[model samples]
Target: MKKIVLATSLLLLTVCSAQAQIASAYAGRLQSVLDSVGKRFHIKGLSAAVYRPGEGMWTGAYGESYSGVPITTDMYFPIGSNTKTYTSCIMLKLQEAGTLSLDDTIGKWLQNIPNVSGQITIRQMLNHTSGLFSYTNDPGFFTALNSDYTKVWQPEDMLQFIGAPDFAPGTSWEYSNTNYLLAGLIIKKIFNEPYDVTVRRMILDPQGFTNTIIYPAEKRGTIPHGWTVMTTNGPLEDMMVSANYDNTAFLSMATSAGAIVATAEDVAKFWVALMNGKIINSNSLAEMKQFVSINANNGYGLGLFRMRPVNGHVVYGHGGTCFGYLNENMVDSTNGITIAVLTNQDSIDNNQIFNWVVTALHKNTLQMAPLSIAGNEKADDIKIYPNPASNYVDVNLGTANNAKFELIDMTGRNIINTTVDGNYVRVSLSDITPGLYLARLSNTEKGILKTTKLQVVH
Candidate 1:
């Protein structure tokens, strides 16, 4: 008995050692992918962080914050429109506390200059279905912005550029920063304080996000300078010194739309906490995720964007672009994975970098643990229906007992896996984004059985 116990303990230790080595190997591969992408894009600097359910968190930074400052995980970057997510979260929290209702109109909350009516609801504003014109689209707006980079802009001044509605309220979808500016106004009116004060008390302080700030004018010079090109192919220019990097002019007007700055790690942590239901109630979160289809594969939720990538997994988050910064934060809710990518230069292809990093991580996961069953059965006996599924798919394992199944993406990443209780097993595909997937079944005794393609549409 003593010899048997000693052998079992040794086996467990060996398994733990092997797992640690695999994790270390994957971390090295992830860093390599970041380095390659940063060099290819000629990004001034790039910072990213990832959090997996079981693996905890990992962060990487490449290139320079400025000419000589090496980018670090703790350095702040302007998250741009990602501030919409925070603004929307604040609204949902207010609704949960009975402070306000999503059905409330802008006219009810604050006085407006033009086209204000009861038809426009807070829900429509949050989801970009308000049909309001985007102030940023005006050519004269840019002309003025460039002419006087130091001129402070009030919310009403920005509103003057919104000449007309894009379409009837709630009749179409259009992204408009004006909607969020109004949302900020409503927040201030309700709390009887500045928008930033409420944001800090409700979100930053509660989350212990020490690195996240509202971009105060006094500390503008303390942050890393934003870089952008002056002409089509000109050399990089320092936007801060040029009076363009979150200057008082832009910050005063962009309050709720684009004026938040945070480190990559803090961004990832915020999403993780949000996903785990630590920040908002489950019902509020559900309301936030009520996605409105923007296109065949993209959707807009309250403050978040629901995207179905080529890999078929649904990602929830937002992307931001300011004068010289581009950033994105994505959360794979199904797998509890969060990724935050931030760059100091707007020229970088942020989408490519995000996709490459996720792909690398998923590929490493598959390599570390390849899914396989025991036996060697033929590959023609299993059936999956409906062939094109929307919500759920049923798998029929004929004449095979105790089978295991997996739903894989085109990239060969195992997205979902489970065991078959009897002849038929029902798998939930509701959380998955609309795309193509592969269903595979194998018996414990039969090794390999069958594979079939699946199409999901909603």
Candidate 2:
């Protein structure tokens, strides 16, 4: 009996150790994904965090905050549009308390000028089924915004810019910032206080989210500079100074639509807490997940986006894009894994990277090869004949047989996929466009074994 007990104890210990290692490995792979995204997007900085149910959190930060300042895990980012999620949470909490209902019309809450805006239901506003014209899409609004970025905008002022409803309320779906702006107005009317005050009290303070801030007034100390590129191939310019704007004005204007600033870890924690039913009841969460098709390809829930990537993996989250920042906070409801990616740059599609992160985390066993010096050495062995191939490229993998090669473009799209049978593989780049690409070599079982930069020149 004693011998049997000792053997069982040893087996249990080994199993626990293996589990810990697996968790660590997942964390490593997540970091690699973040690094790759930052490089590909040409972002000034990228900060991300991943949280597993029982395992602790893991954070990864890459690139510079400024010209020389390296980004840290604690840096703050403007979570544009993600503020809508928080606002929706507040509305749900109010519903739970019987103070309000989702079916309530905007006319019942606030004395609005526009009949169409007032007739829009709260549910329609939250889910973006409201037909209100997006104020952000207005040419006059952009004209004013570009002229004076520091101009303080009141919610009432924004209403003037919204010309008319696209259609009747709830008839169709469109992503309108005006809907969220009105929602913010309703919150203020209900609580008899500023929307930011209510958010801080109900969400930020209770959750102990120290890094999250609803920018009340413009002060730029801890926050990293926001950046924007003129074109896909253009250099990044500092919007803070170049645009001659204070973030406070932009924050005030964005309010409940796109104003929340938070670090990656805090965003992940917020999503995890919400998913675990710590914020609202399970019923509210269910309502939030009750998705309606925004288009044939995409779906929208209450302040949340339901994404079905090419891999067919479903994730619920929000993507935020302000003047100079783009962010994504996603959750895998099945496994309770949360991923938050925050960047201080604009115009890049972060969904592809976020989807990859979700797919990798969902797999039973994360099949990733070493992405360090060892992997680089293996990549060095496989040589491409021309440093910059014009039409065709020859990859000499030497003894690396049965390896699969994938040529991925800068947009995170796989442009080519072929298999290597023997020592050498010839690839025709005649049809391929002249640009940058990543050549990834891997096997069926080991996942990505090696990756190298490949340049195509016309």
Best by TM-score: 1
User: What's the lDDT for candidate 2?
Assistant: 0.70
| Ten-residue region with minimum lDDT total, candidate 1 | 1-10
Model 2 TM-score on a 0 to 1 scale: 0.71
lDDT tens digits, residues 125-184, model 1?
999999887777767677766676667776667766776888998888888887888888
Which runs of model 2 end up more than 4 angstroms from their true locations?
1-26, 115-117, 217-221, 230-234, 309-312, 350-458
Displacement of residue 302 (Cα, Å) in model 1 is 0.4
Task: Write out the backbone clash pairs for model 2.
Answer: 81-258
lDDT of each: 0.70, 0.70
